[model samples]
Target: MGQAAPSKDEVARRLADIGPGEEREIGEGVFMTMHRLQAIQPLGDGWHRAQSTEGSFSVELPLPFNDFRVRAQATDNVEMRTHTVGGKTPGLLAWSASCLARRDGKLGPEARAPGSDKIEVKGTPPVAHSRSVDLDDMTCILIVEAQGSDPVPPEADRLRFLHSLKRTGRPAW
Candidate 1:
């Protein structure tokens, strides 16, 4: 004979007991860290790295996600640059852009980008490309454009930049 399954109310109660921004062990070795808007589930095998700061935000990336250079940083903006390999364009690059709206040292909703329209400047030798996405509390902008007549970067480079972004926290109300 096996133990009876928990009732719906019991399950609800158990879930309700978990406070916001709390970390709870959900499996034999896995832990689920809760946030106001997201839940971070790190690997039990120790392959994930935490990029969290006290009372700030948290983000974990896979082990292979590395080798990036800090291109710019400010009180509200952070940009990281990395290049792609095995592509036709050897110098193709990507960026992880995070522009936060901070009020009283807490995150808040910022101006959202209108849409993802691939805008290209006319009459320019090198192609000028720009795209922006609204990340709830921030706006992530990625620009892969002309660099002194350099050939347009491969599409794979832009995809890599979009896939590399990981948000650790939620936007403020």
Candidate 2:
């Protein structure tokens, strides 16, 4: 006869002890992989460089952050790639990319120089900054949003996050 299956509690205990960068089979044909988050390295004065999981872009954020990537269907033929980085402290940043082909091969009228603006909302932070860049057939937008009770992030911090976005010429999608 086959061996009895492990108890739920026993499986939980085994999973609890698994270390990062490790993988284990808890049951027949069932595997779990543990991944360690990339370290957020400091660049002095409360700023750190946050890189996308795909290494396509990097931006300077005021605090340690965790980032994730997502892909969504934008249209029948185009998909959107979104990379978001946020910290527990007080800000959220994201980069989004989509094919420029959807826009009839031209930049939209809103595609102006990168800048910051004040957006007043009753119970939310009032600052939103964004910039758009065109790379080959892709259009990428970088946005930094203020969070928490503060009316806005420090001017320097907001600008740093907005102006520090760098793309490595890699395809975002």
- Candidate 1 residues lying further than 4 Å off, grouped into runs, are 1-96, 104-126, 170-173
lDDT per residue, candidate 1, 101-122, as tens digits? 3332322224344333343332
Candidate 2, superposed: residue stretches over 4 Å from native: 1-39, 88-125
TM accuracy, model 2: 0.53
TM-score of each: 0.34, 0.53
- Shift in Å, residue 9, candidate 2: 28
Across residues 112-146, which tens digit of lDDT does each residue of candidate 2 receive?
33333232222334455566666543455555554
Query: What lDDT score goes with residue 60 in model 1?
Result: 34
Q: Please give the range of 10 consecutive residues that has the lowest summed lDDT in model 1.
A: 80-89
Model 1, residue 61: distance off in Å is 12
lDDT of 2: 0.51
Cα deviation of 62, candidate 2, in Å: 0.8
